[model samples]
Target: KKNMVKTGKAALLLWCQKRTEGYKGVQVTNFTKSWKDGLAFAALYHSFYPDEIPFNSLSSKSSAEILEMCFACGLRHGIPRLLDVEDIVEMPSPEPFSMMTYLSQCYHTMEGGQKGRSGLASIQVNESQQRQQPA
Candidate 1:
């Protein structure tokens, strides 16, 4: 039962990386075998098929034990959710007037001018005038 559980977790981890919908542009630089991987595999499995199995009854070993094993690898060594992998297809250059630039220009025009305050200046001036008045 223990061996089968371990094997199932390993296969699931490999399968997650293998799928297209999996992490984009991620490479499997290193595969770490730890309890965390087992927990993650079980979690992923449960997420996909909630009706298949219950979390509490996952393994003969206590859930806490499994979880500790998962994190036992420590910060230095653990399974990376995604690794540094380059995309095969080259992306095209962005247009000169992209939405971001266009929005920035609009915001600047509305907020204030480069030389001095524009929209906010008038509001400040009015506020100052009101403050001067008794009230």
Candidate 2:
């Protein structure tokens, strides 16, 4: 059971890393410490809805403010506000399960809006299809 949990966490972490790959200053190494600054959540949100949230403009905000914006955006898109901003802001590292649950909800919410595949998978499929086409 422990190993299964670890594997699940690893997969979720990898999914987040792939989603937030090119966003500046956002590195998702884990569900806890990596999200302490709230940039990871913002990056993930921006990755799916780039036009909705300006990624570059978030640099000036405090961590709490950033988290508030991110959570608000999520709520707008129907993802529940699972993690409290105060709890996250006060802790050096937020609780892993809470982070993971919130992240998983974000993942499902974003991916559900896609055409039956994750964003990364859709991009890869498009690239492969383009490669197979004749000049």
- All candidates: CA RMSD in angstroms? 24.2, 5.8
Tens-place lDDT per residue, model 2, 1-135, is: 986566566656767888899888888887788888888888999988888777799878999998998999999999999999988989878998999988878877888855423554444556557879999
Lowest lDDT sum, 10 consecutive residues, model 1, at 81-90
List lDDT for all candidates, in order. 0.35, 0.82
Summarize candidate 1's per-residue lDDT along 1-135 as a digit string, tens digits.
986545433433343343213422233322332222244433433343445434446567654443443223221232321211111012132232231232223233323446322433444455557879997
The residue ranges of model 2 lying beyond 4 angstroms of the native Cα positions read 113-135
Backbone clashes in model 2, listed as residue pairs: none
**Alpha-carbon shift of residue 109 in model 1 (angstroms):** 48
Q: Best TM-score goes to which candidate?
A: 2
Candidate 1: Cα lDDT at 116: 27
Give me the runs in candidate 1 sitting further than 4 Å from their true place: 1-30, 35-37, 59-135
